[model samples]
Target: MREDVGEVTTSLHRPTTDSSRSKPVRYESFEWPQQQQQPPSNGVPRSAWNRQHRRLSRWHRPYTAVLVFLDLISTLAASEIADVFLEKSKSGFQHKSWLFLQGSALFTFFAYVVLPLGWLLLLWTNGTYDRRYLGLGSEEFKRIVRTSVTVVAAVSLLAFATKTDLSRGTVATVSLCALLFILLCRVTARQVLHLARRRTGHGAHRMVLVGTLPEALEVYTAVTRSPAAGLIPVAIHITDGYAAARGIETPVPVYAGRDVLSLVREVGADTIAVCGSASAEPGELRRLAWQLEGTGVDLVVAPQLTDIAGPRVHIRPIEGLPLLHVEEPTLSGPGWLVKNLLDRVVAGLGLALISPILAVIALGIRLSDPGPVFFRQTRVGHDGRTFRVWKFRTMYVDAEERKATLEELNESDGMLFKMKHDPRIFAFGQKLRATSLDELPQLINVLKGEMSLVGPRPLPADDGDYLGDVRRRLLVRPGITGLWQVSGRSDLSWDEAVRLDLYYVDNWSLTYDLSILWRTIWVVLKRKGAY
Candidate 1:
């Protein structure tokens, strides 16, 4: 029997003496030999090994079943909706019999049986149900989109080859509706899984950390802070020598890295994350890979590269050696032109649509406070240029005068000043800040080319001129709402906000902008991290 120590179980190799059995074995007392030994090939029995494989399958099987069910329902419902809409239209679909199936009866057979099954088959072949990507990342969604396109292309080709007259409207509507439904279902499923991981620690990977004390600690801090990543560090192996473990403050038990395979087996860690320069040792990582071959364990390498998105990074293999090629940040070119055009167009339409709300806000501010309806502040913009950022006033006229007294209460670690409840904000101003309604006036700035719909938030000119890589954020126009705004707003530390802003500047894309805009809506609705 094994003893439980917090979330991690104690080593399984404790002595079975009477005294030892009665007393719990502490994690710090566990030790391994300095010399590395080859892992035993047949340490676990064949039946037990098979059971290990079955355990993983058991975890993902239910989720996969749920996905399959959802996909079937979505496809069938889409087909039925298309059939009904087309049947009711003036240009009614001409139904033809195929495979001994006329009229609405033939359409019903295809809708109820053929379309759903074919969609499932295509999705399966496209790896949409792969366990590795089922509830994580955007790979699953990409596969679903690719499969949808394939379905449309395949149907068109088949109809042309057979010289059969299939209604163009039916094919287009069913395909589009099915794609939307599947994508929605996937997004919902991912959110539910993330919630479970955050609240209950369910579906988390039990991982062992391997590297020097500092590197391992960095990885540990990152994973623990992000519960949605689902990495639970159970043990640490100091690769710089066990002496490096001295004076370290780690939440998990620390052990010598001389024999990683033994440590993993003792703790039952399903994943091993080699951090920082630990993999640089010649043949060390290769040897670890050989050891993990049939143990049903996953090996992950955490490269030092941080905050870079997937589109910017690519693997280029030359003569069997894989090298990472990071593309330069897109600061100019056709993409920037498109982004600029989009910003102006969106801002123009938004201002037109919400002009009434803007007027009401202006009136409320005018009545609530004795000041200008709009506040203008000089802020650093693209290429170090300064511009007046406009916003519905959310503070009293004397707010600036009171700032000197509130300086000591500022909680931010960096240049920005932040307070959860500022005394200068009136009752109505607080509501405006919470719902971000005060920011609606920035559409005018975007339309005037002084800002963007999505980019780094402009900082006050008093924040000082940015130097080094931080200046990269000024390559693009400042925005009304950005990554920093959606992520945490005033709640984030100064360094974190800068890091998020820099990341946005380096990895800007149209799709990325769209995703940020979508998340911004939710952030505003939830009023998360708002002052």
Candidate 2:
């Protein structure tokens, strides 16, 4: 069980895991145009919308059913495997197997029936099939983990109380294996639904955002981009306090404050999402919920805190007043130690595994340019300390001296000076930059403990435009690849780049880091946003 928890840390994937680029499709200042621009009639009848909601809401029953089947299969498979596995251990160390075999040398009938039934009951009663966890698989997956842990704890206590001999190794193996199968079932199901949505726009909950322009647009971008979340915005209802005097045009239908309910009926929007500004008022939302009672429309409230994930936020109700608590991010903990250790191991393995390529790159760089093979520049590190970040030189030795002459050609955002076709690099150097081989040598800094395998990109120490509140990102070691690497590399805007960096620091986890690493593989290969 310890090894199971350690292998795939739940903290690896935070509850608010969103990997998409979340920037909104903003327009000129919204003028709150008079006419309610209805959704273009796709001829998708209103009955189709109701069927979609039914599928989304009740998907959990089938989801849980699949879980039960997978658990049964996992139990049978683990029994066979564990019996064989623990047999060797038994012969070697006088251990017991997991099957609870009777005198006939076969499993007891109760093992097959009682245990599987218990699993289903525990899972169901523990809220694994809750409506809120249906489409988006994060919560559903988490509940499975919670159920497995709690059951294991209960079994351990029962064994101790009854003075029954329980094979710790066998129990751990079956629990972990069963969990693996259950999650696999959920992942496969969610992907099927995601494919349905992508191909046909089926099984998604249509939404209408009601709030001020800027904040509403933020929510709009999030829901629209994250189709897997099963929330899609079909219309907008701008409220007061928006910059309505200025002209603005939304990509979708726009509605007035009074026409939100009518717009929902017009488009069959199942979710009435109330975002920031006047629409988020308690009295107003209560009234909205009251109106939505029998209409089958769900009311969702998105808080002003953007980009923060679920684990950090807690709702505490005291005297009927609910208060939100946000846990501050800390860099010092056992988790940090695990991350630090993982950084060195992976970086070392990475360098060793790619030694021949590193050598070949070294040879190519030396032959291409009659200068240093390595580029070392001062970069801001954790807590604002400066370190010489290493990289395979992908430019001429006089790259810095040529900066002034190329200042007029800068195409990058903020204070970042970049040019897609910069003349400063040697001929072969451009390929390295394009393929991201130029940053490979930063693995050395990672091994040297000056950087991490995944964290914010280490920028030049003198880059001042984004040095304000973003300096908090310096609280952890910089990385060779990060949200920036998989996000858009150098193609991201100044604000987007900083936002990704800050988000990484705030949502640091082994799972998040591994995801970035995995995405980096394809992002680097395709060179999508590389310049």
TM-score leader: 1
lDDT of each: 0.77, 0.70
lDDT of 1 by residue, 407-472 (tens): 999988887788998899988899999999989999999999999999998989987889887788
- Supply the global lDDT for candidate 1: 0.77
Q: Model 2 over residues 46-88: C-alpha lDDT tens digits?
A: 5544532232133345555765677667666655565565555
**Per-residue error at 305 for model 2, in Å?**
1.9
Where does model 2 exceed 4 Å of error? 1-76, 83-113, 134-140, 154-168, 184-203, 225-227, 241-246, 257-259, 341-357, 367-370, 396-409, 419-435, 462-466, 509-511, 518-522, 525-527
**What TM-score do all the candidates reach, one by one?**
0.87, 0.75
- In model 1, the clashing pairs are none
> RMSD of candidate 2 to the true fold?
12.0
